[model samples]
Target: MSTIEDAAVWLAAADPDPIHARRWIGSARIILLPLGERWSAVKVSEHQGLAAAAALRGPSIHDPSGQCVYFLVAPHTVWDAPGSECLGESYWLTVPTPAVKEPPGPYWLRAPDGSGQLVDAEELRAQLGARSVSAAGAASVKQP
Candidate 1:
């Protein structure tokens, strides 16, 4: 975040549920942006008031939990700048965090010729669980 207050503003504006906000906003940023665009995110610390924003660099690789993981090349810098640094944290919201009971956002799959098709959330949950889809909008996952 640019200013300390900006972080607060972001937190305030996000969904009331912290976990939901993280998943929804985070997923939105991941799926909507260009396949390889990187971004900075100030991860709000549940234990504390604030922590430095991580690079949140992505379209990288998906984490084991099916959440896409990125490097927080540096901290305190939320503005997007090429080659910036951010802080990466694996202890998101502290472990044992509740799995998002709701769908993060709409999931899209790419077709053979390069077309994006929207898919249902249930379909997404199954595919993600199976790790069957390689890349979003990259290929279909058995067309079911």
Candidate 2:
């Protein structure tokens, strides 16, 4: 098999139910961390999200309905940020399968390229904080 396909298969090993109808589903193999007890997510708008993903140069997921992007981090990762969502153990994030890279549904903005690469929690927190500060500054500026 090709490298990407092999990587996809390797990544999919995290699937709790590989046989399930939906190729995409919740995975427990890697912990999503950032400002939480265990799993946390930093949601960013479409444009900013894309930029952040590019800046990080790591795996990220895009949710069309939510109009945001998510960067999956390592199990041991952690960060403290205001808007971050702390997901409990029961919370199962629906992720796209190896083949589902693009979206009509939740899809990978930056799929794992078989390097076992994930977003760094510290880097993500910094990006979010910087964006938040910039947004606040813009909002507080007086209209001419």
Candidate 3:
């Protein structure tokens, strides 16, 4: 199977309606992590979120509202970034099939790439902190 197909299968394993039909695309699933808790996510503002994802070079999902982004992180990560919220157990994420790459709805900014890659929580925290400081400094500057 191709990489994306593999990713599709991997992700679809979480579908609660598995017995109804094996959907490969054109639908989304409300899922916990597959493979005994494989990942978690951090939700942040699109501004800093995209920048952090670019810096970290990891997969992220851009929310339909375009105001926020969800950065996928390794399972059991302790994420306490000031401006971001960690999504874990008891939290369900709506994930579109691997084939959906753009919106009207949530889609990948950086797609999974079939590598099972996830962002490092510490690096994401640092990047967000630096950006927040920069933004705060810019906002506080008085007009000359």
The number of the candidate with the highest lDDT is 3
Instruction: Give the CA lDDT, 0 to 100, for residue 90 in model 1.
Output: 26
lDDT of 2 by residue, 1-144 (tens): 665565556465554543442243234222222222323345667766776687786678888888888777765354467766434344456656555677678877777676666678788877877888898999999998
Those runs of model 3 whose alpha carbons end farther than 4 Å from true positions after fitting are 14-36
What TM value does model 1 have?
0.17
The Cα local distance difference test for each model comes to 0.26, 0.62, 0.72
**Whole-model lDDT, model 3:** 0.72
Instruction: List clash counts for every candidate, in order.
Output: 9, 0, 0
Angstrom error of the Cα, residue 113, model 3: value is 2.1
* Candidate 1 local lDDT, residue 23: 54
Off by over 4 Å in 1: 1-62, 80-144
Question: Which has the greatest TM-score?
Answer: 3
Residues 1-144 of candidate 1: C-alpha lDDT, one tens digit per residue: 333233323332322354554454444332111111122222222211111112211111212333333222122333332222233332222111122212343121111111111122233233233332334345754675
Scored by Cα lDDT, where does model 1 land? 0.26
Candidate 2, superposed: residue stretches over 4 Å from native: 17-48, 86-88
Residue 54 lDDT, candidate 3, scale 0-100:
77
